[model samples]
Target: MLINIMGFLVSYVFCLIITPLISKLALKLNAVDIPDHRKVHVKPMPRLGGLGVYLAFIIGLIVIGFPIMSNIQVILGATLIVILGILDDIYILKPYQKLIIQFVAALVVVYGHVSVDFLYLPFIGTVDLSVSIIPITVLWIIGITNSINLIDGLDGLASGISFIIVFVFVILAIINQQDTILMLSFVLLGSILGFLYHNFFPARIFLGDSGSLFLGFMVSVISLMGLYKTVTVSSLFLPVIILGLPLMDTFLAIFRRLKKHQSVMAPDKEHLHHQLIKFGLSHRKAVLLMYMLSATFGIVAIIFSKAILWGTLLFSLLVIFISHYFYNYNFNKIIHFLNRKYNKT
Candidate 1:
């Protein structure tokens, strides 16, 4: 454990110290994201910032891995995410193309044998899944990857929220006697902290697709592995609930887009965080608020880990309520105005 902590600290500092120069190079190369009328930021910022983060995470894992969690699956799964995300970052791959790559990566994680064992009935006991966990796991992996990707619209938001989530998982891993998750927690913690140095408001860089997809996949895979032995079917819902903020936000964004007869994959600045930003908050403030919400849901999930089924439903409902209330209160007019003014664009 001590060794793992040391590894994390080293890797974290290396990535943190190194990201600024790397970002400068990306800027020189014109690998920058120019903020548009819809984007939250008001300047041109270099992306591909995940390069440093991915390198730092791998280095930390390679140097000091926990007994269980830091296996070849982490290596392979992370590699795929980084590779696919880099492709998207550079060339803007089509949705279908990225989906295929993500599916293949999801399969690799599945082969790692991190699976949902059984569905827990409310009054009844656990029912082992007869069908394949393939579809379920794939959807989870892809969904989470996109959730984090979209939330990256705000500075430090994705990485900070992820850091908190990983921190909670680290604590949970310790309590559950699962040392494997420690290595992952260590690397993720280190990478996010390092990345945050550049990602904070008045940002120097954006994580681009590379970092978002990479961390998202890691979070989903690690969380599943941690709970595989403990959760039943109803308990399975906890993962979704634990990630309620991102998942719910993604779902509603897609729902809103579909209702407007727009492409679900279209890039827009109306994500949950962005909506909050449009409602008179600064970029940093909105990100911080979401970070608080993310941490709140995370803590709630940990507090109710034992009441798997009930916890899942209740938390999910809570997420829906908050999102609906916020959207209705803060965003109905904005969406209508945007639709009238910019939907054609």
Candidate 2:
């Protein structure tokens, strides 16, 4: 355990020390996200921040001496995402093209047998979802990828969320006594923290599509392994509630798009960060608040996992209610009022 932790830390420091240099190179290459009316930031910031994270992650894994797997599906899936994202960063691929790439990556994970095979329903017994697990797992992977991608609008947003999730996964893995996942989480956590050095506030570089998709895929795969690796799904709620921020963001985005009759993949400025900014929060403050929200859910998940079913149920509802109260900052009301006034003509 200690050795695994050490390997992760060594790679983490390696990543941290090199992150600024990566940002500098990104800037020099003009791989920056330029400002637009819909964008929160007002400057040109270099992107493809995922490259450093991916490089550091792979280096950490190799250093940890687990490069080869029985099937190597996770490695291949993540690599595909990185390549697809890198290409999109350079050439700005069409939405369809990007979706196709994402689907392909999910397919690798699904067919590679790294998917969630069943839901270990608490008390209700094991729910065999094998026959339909493929489609469900694909959607889960693809949805999570896009969720993280869209949530990357704010500096430090996606990185911070990834940090929160991986941290929780590490803890869960330890409790479950899943040595492989526990070690994997350490390396992942370390690598992500290394990226945060450059990805944090007053960001030097954006993660672009590559980093977000890579992160989303990793979180999905790792969580599945943590909870579904065995014959039971006794603690699936932990990951779901723990990932409240991204899941809620994804849920809201889909509903908002559907309501507007827009394509689910339609780009917009109505993300969680954008709403917070509209409510007069600074970028730093908004991101920090989100971090706090993420931390709260993470901590609650840990506590909930140790509680009884009824107790966990109550705790989950309380978290949701609190989230609802705080998240409703009335941005939609403002938009509606403005639309009404303008449409009076």
Candidate 3:
């Protein structure tokens, strides 16, 4: 307990101290975001802020005397992710280039016993997935990594959402008595919160790819560590629920693009936050509303974790209803077009 608190505080304070320096470095290196037609910000802002959060997390781990060797693969993959992010931020790497590195990093961690080999389902006992573990793990890591990067549009939006998700993971850790997750969650919560101070409304710096990708990678890894092992049929949905907002945004983007015959990697102004903004909400209000939505998902995850058959059934019903309603209203044109195409067939 004491060590967790220490790690949290150390990471928080260090992030606060280091972020300003990183911001300056970003300026010096011309690592900044320029406002464009698809962007929301009005002025160029320094990036590479993720470097501060990364350094703070490392310092916190050192102070806590964490066993580096035990989690060497995870750390190594994260380091590679951060490096990839830094390079992308400075040089704007193509989507394929970034995807290649993400795959490599994910594979590196999978080689170190981080793969999901089995799942515990309600009434069905354990199902072995040894043969599919590598692909599943790689897909999850990359999916989450890009999901977070895709939602980094608004100020403090990604950071706050990530903070909420990690805090929920902290609660799950304490409930499951997972010491490593608890420690990692605390330090992460602290580092993100500290950065959010400078990142919130009218931000001084942007997370760029560096911060967003790193947060997404770490969160995905932590979820694998803490939640995957305890997954029951009901709890199997917990990770998706906890990361609901980002995952939803990610899937929606892909679906929308595919339906329009556009490239999945093409940029657009129809993200959830953008939709909220278009609906007349202020930037801050949109972000806060999304924060509330993510928190709601977190609560559902906690409930599902302790729930039984009936609870899982209710969750499934709720998901179906929400999906139908959201798709009907949010993407009416696409849905209508699909319906027409089906009828003709």
Q: Estimate every model's Cα lDDT from 0 to 1.
A: 0.79, 0.80, 0.90
Error of 2 at 329 (Å): 9.3
TM-score: model 3 vs. ground truth: 0.93
Tell me the TM-score of each prediction against the true structure: 0.87, 0.89, 0.93
Clashing pairs in 3: none
User: Candidate 2's residue-wise lDDT over 199-238, tens digit each?
Assistant: 8888878888778888988888887767666543336676
Candidate 3 C-alpha lDDT tens digits along 122-146: 6787889989999999999999999
Return whichever of 1 and 2 wins on TM-score.
Answer: 2
Q: So what's the TM-score on candidate 1?
A: 0.87
Task: Determine which window of 10 residues in candidate 2 has minimal summed lDDT.
Answer: 334-343
Compose the digit string of candidate 1's lDDT tens values, residues 1-345.
797688779779988988988787777766778778778777787888887898888788667744435367657877988988877777778999988989988888788877655666666777776485888778878888888887888889888888988888887788787777777788779988988988888778889888899989888888777865664543655566578788978998999899999999988877888777666666666787788788888887676675556665686687679868875784657545544554356
The CA-based lDDT of model 1 is what? 0.79
User: Candidate 1: deviation at residue 318, Å?
Assistant: 8.0
Q: Count the backbone clashes (under 3 Å) in each candidate.
A: 5, 1, 0
Q: Considering only N, C-alpha and C atoms within 3 Å, which residue pairs clash in candidate 1?
A: 69-180, 118-233, 119-233, 120-233, 120-234
TM-score of candidate 2 on Cα atoms, chains taken together: 0.89
Prediction RMSDs, each to the true structure: 5.7, 5.9, 6.6
